[model samples]
Target: MLVQNSLSEVLRAREELFTRTIWTDPTSQLQNRVKGSELSRYFLLTESERIGIEQTIRLLVSTTPYYLSLSDPTDPNCPIRRMIVPTAEEAVFSLEESSDPLDEERLSPVRGLTHMYPNRVLLFSNHSCSVYCRHCMRGRKVSSSGERMEKADLETAFDYIRNHHEVEDVVVSGGDPLNLADARLEWILHELNQIPHVRICRLGTRNPVTLPFRITDELCKIIERYNDDNLSIFCHTQFNHPKECTKEAKDAILRLLKVGVSVGNQAVLLKGINDDEEIMLTLHKKLLEMRVRAYYLYDPELIPGSRGFRTPLARGIEIVEYMRGKIGGMGIPHFVNDLPGGGGKITIGANWYLGYYPKTRQHAFRSAVTKKIHFSFEPVGSDKESYYPVLSEADWEKFQAE
Candidate 1:
């Protein structure tokens, strides 16, 4: 368990490790974030690469100095740089890609509240982030114009949740909920606590990865206040690469854990970023060490300008299969794809269950350890019965008797 004293020690050492001026202040960190084209000041880019990034600025390009400090300025192929810096490939779009790939807007009954799942709803609290990820599925809204949820908007969303008694889960997301002021975030949590039906409130933010300074003691206190038996609060963050699991990021996660707020990572499988098996294994292992559970390894969504970052669906399965026995079960995340057109998330994995053969009265499975096919016969006198395979007359008679 992380104590306050240890966290203070980490914060004090930040200056030694990172020369950034705003390592302790969240507001200063945001104010100093490098915006589009400004990224070249921190990272070295060729003339063509610079032009390509400028062209894709329509999607918004922003990164905190702390995050930028992690990149290799000389290496354009650096995984950390590839995530925040846009490329010419983003300009090339397929007909299958969409601005609202998840169909979030179509499912949204209110201005910012999307009620896609029966018992859950996603609330867009604001339109700002510490860093604008190039592969964001919500590229249409996030970091577009610095719009935020006003009091009226919050009330409307709150009213919607109140009316719908079936809504047990409310996901407070936006550009990133942590970007919201502490008072506002507390108000949002308080409102949800009032709703008898609402039992779970999830704050979806990438601040922990991009801007760990945002997870202050004050913020954790607000989270601890409302997080109780009645309303459980969980922070769902995205950490795509192993480099993101820095000491600061781990300390941020520890702060949340110290407050009884569970932290989980939902990493997207990017083509050149974290598609490798070893990279993912190391990331999950680090997350477990920080007491953050590995939640979902998402297959990249079919969002506009994101084809450059997306990997084949099969690639995600292969990574999951490779990591199964290598890591603890808790460290392994569910590999899932959030279907386009808001069809919702569905878990996908390697076909370990080959098939069931009635002819042999057995089930076939591919062994994870041996990487070979194996079979197990159906138990006799099971409550559920299937057509048994043909056998010798004596054997058939014995089977029937059993």
Candidate 2:
């Protein structure tokens, strides 16, 4: 709820930023995206770099003008460029990598709908993105075709959700859910809002980072409309590094928060992008400043052609361990690994619990922040009250007066 000003101010400022650039048309940014070999025209790529990119281009290669402007054309190792541009390393596949590492297709109850958990389901709203990330886990599905969910497909998914009362959460994701037309997106929200049993609807998108212009007043109005006492709406976006926390990105996040939409970030721990503890900490801290919660810091999935981005499991643990007390708890995201082969997600972090002694009824723990050992004695059976402090009559009387 940071920027509670009028929507016109936000739009005017956004337009001013792009007034002299080719990205003046906010709505057409997606359609005007640069792709594949066309990248050479925008960035000053050397001959070797151009060939390397062309050779390693397997997944769809595209980036919005807004995102492309964030990169340093001369630096090949620029984090922004590394995310959207392919390198020769992408062609080198590892034995453990799989296109569908999570086995989402096998676990799908209906086409485009993956009912992985009992209470929640993932709905693929579209198969397009303004910027096709090089380390995308769903590289096989996303950006393969510029397809949106048809009415029939949506009805089938809706029917499944309606039939299963146990499902209270629905995650509308895709290459990017915001990529869909405003009317189309509104329709999906409307249908989901009609579901009486559904309590939470989360829109998974990276627009705030990749295409801030997409978060228009009209889109926010649609989001605000569906949000009510019956159902709550939340937006989960990706922002891997502090550089991505631009003024435009902050405005977009504030716009969502200004409405009733709860905004959160799910940063991926990429090798060359945000593997460093300092970088990750800065990214999360910036997100907190924008009124966005740091939700998850994901360990990169074993997606094909993503070996260059993946870091050793120990690296993620080390980064999270380093961030323990540097910032507030709200800025620290849960380090998690979405297990491959449909095993599901599990939290991965430094272990705090040391051991427990039966005879002494004591539990030992190591502080992640202070790096000190502490012990706590459990109360005897049916005597939990003994563990709490007892106030004297005089102390109780003084507390009441206060």
Candidate 3:
């Protein structure tokens, strides 16, 4: 087990961290992580720098000692440092920016429940993450004390799911589901398990990377209990850079896998962080090596105070296209844009469509791998049923059983 301490309790936990293989909170265990380093004689701090840090502190402020240690103090553009370190760049908001870029409120049936797609829904469980991520999509709500889910909200979510028969999946997300005490999380999962309509329960959390100490043996038992055949539970974690795959992080992930809860990663494509092709490739490869599947490579949202992280959509497309033949299928995730204005997740990849003409009765496509042009004439007098690979109900059941 690992232990983290507040500033005052820092010395008490030092011996445990030093002597044992267990990791201690590198930045002290407090969720509100600010102040770059010790304010000792190592380097005289300036008033201007302190003032700048204070302004950014007005927004969400948090990071683990473990996550911060991955950064290079010398380089201003260090990807990990850019992620956790607060700066005045976050204070600036563009005119086109929005608080809810996805406009999730538009799709919400209730306050905390968002039913965007017919078959899947999102349960915004709570909003107190152990560490506040700089490039979080839900920047408007995350880390704020008001983001925590209330009893009424949970009841409303259950009611919404009960009423809507079309919904088969419920994505439990918030600041981080794992941030909740094991008992509270178990109660939520137990209630969710009672709903027969909910086939899958996916928990999206960043604790495995930012705060591995939370992955206790008790929590592992809770996951294993909820992950039965009828109602399945899966965990979705975020790790932007390869450096985030630290020993403790990997151990946390392995614990989940050991309990039969499959894990997957969803990485945001940030400009100075992981926007480059090589960085993304390495991140993807590392995720698979830990036995976690690469699920989604998300495009940064145009939210207020997040212009610093946004990357060109074209750059994301190129990275996905380039990795098509290079890595194995499990290593590749959908390079997706959670399109603005409540428009769903749209995959952004190399466009294969070149051109099509009705009069000439021809269609052209540019192959992504070979970069070669291919043309074909419009089909005439073809049987629609036989042309496509259509599976019957019995065949589908057989295939699934196999």
- lDDT values, one for every candidate: 0.83, 0.82, 0.74
Candidate number with greatest lDDT: 1
Give the distance in Å from residue 183's predicted Cα in candidate 3 to where it truly belongs.
Answer: 0.4
**For every candidate, C-alpha RMSD to the true structure in Å:** 7.8, 10.0, 9.1
**Decreasing lDDT order of the candidates:** 1, 2, 3
**For model 3, how does the per-residue alpha-carbon lDDT over 1-402 read when each residue is reduced to its tens digit?**
112234344433333333342345432454434334331111122343243345552247566555555665445577776776555556677898888888898898898888888899998888877777777778777877777798788888898898888889999998788877777899889888888888899999998888886787888999899889768999999999988988888889999999999999998888888888888888888888888898998988887667778877898888988777778989988999888898899877776664544444455566666766666666875434244333345544443354
Sort the predicted structures by TM-score, highest score first: 1, 2, 3
Candidates 1 and 2 compared: the better one by lDDT is 1
Please provide TM-scores, in order, for all candidate models, with all chains considered together.
Answer: 0.89, 0.87, 0.81
Off by over 4 Å in 3: 1-52, 353-369, 373-380, 383-402
Put down candidate 2 lDDT per residue, 1-402, tens digits, no spaces.
112223455345335444545564566677667787666555556554565476763578888879877887667779998887787777777799898888999988887899889999999888888899998888888887644567788899999999999999999999799988899899999999999999999999999999998899989999999999888999999999888999999999989998989998898999888999999989888988988898998999988778789899999889888898998988988999999988889999787765555445665667887777676777677355444444455544443354
* Residue pairs with backbone overlap in model 3: 26-65, 27-65
Q: lDDT (0-100) at residue 139 of candidate 1?
A: 82
Model 2, TM vs. native: 0.87
Give the CA lDDT, 0 to 100, for residue 274 in model 2: 92
Largest TM-score belongs to which candidate? Answer: 1
Poorest 10 consecutive residues of model 3 by lDDT? 37-46
